[model samples]
Target: MDLQYVNFFAVAVLAAVIGVTLIVVHLSQRKLRAELTQLREELALWQKAGLHAPRAVAAAEPDARPSQAQGAPMAPAPQPLSEEQIRERLQQAAGAGEAPERYRHVVTLADKGLAPEEIARVLQVSSAEAQQLVRLAEVGRKKS
Candidate 1:
């Protein structure tokens, strides 16, 4: 084949690949956006029904742990955490820029008297990290 023809073919192939990739990305983003919107709507419903925490978190109380350890069923429902309370906790979390936002949220929830497990569930963090943040918050409180 002529050099110019070979170059044209390669460019055409590259353009086709780019086009396919852009289409794939666009479709993936659309799917993700739809899923996110659905989740947000479900969250709004749950909030309206006064169910902020999961059933598992309801059984995470210090007094409730013993029953769970013995294979008892979880609590009927978690305490109703109002939207205003969540907003207040987030506002407190926003006050400190010394740590990452996730860490700050964890500490704020801990300070608000939420258990490590509850904080983990609310913030979508690992339980171990939430426990550490809670302990860190405790130490900070003691120092002040």
Candidate 2:
């Protein structure tokens, strides 16, 4: 085969891969748009329910401490918190990993006779998770 033909074939393959990637990206974007819409709706509901996180401390808020006189004595430093205290204070910090509340809630809802779909919708979790929760709750019930 000619080197020129081989080069052209490689270039053609590269173009095809790029085209397919772009198509996949377009499809993914569409799915993301749908998810965005759902998220917006959930956010609105959260706002209406007054479930928003605390507002960030902004520059507009005045400092709580008044300016000290030029020779004011320094305040005593606060004692350091213990490891358990620090862990308690840092509950749910970033990188803490998955919370089990959803699983517990799923089991609770299942025990309350809610279907897997209803539990998933109420908890905003996957149907599979809700089903597993129901199974877990059933096992517990049998064990007890």
Q: Judging by TM-score against the true structure, name the best candidate.
A: 1
User: How much lDDT does candidate 2 score?
Assistant: 0.58
Mind giving the per-residue lDDT tens digits that candidate 1 earns over 35-143? 9997787567546545563344556554533355688665444344455554454456547544454555666566667888787676554566676667655555554
Clashes of each: 0, 0
The weakest ten consecutive residues by lDDT in model 2 span: 53-62
Q: Which stretches of candidate 2 lie over 4 Å from their true place?
A: 53-144
Cα misplacement distance, residue 85 of candidate 2 (Å): 49
- Which pairs clash (backbone N, Cα, C closer than 3 Å) in model 2? none
Q: What is the C-alpha RMSD of each candidate to the true structure, in Å?
A: 14.7, 17.2
In terms of lDDT, which candidate is strongest?
1
- In order, the Cα lDDT scores of the candidates are 0.64, 0.58
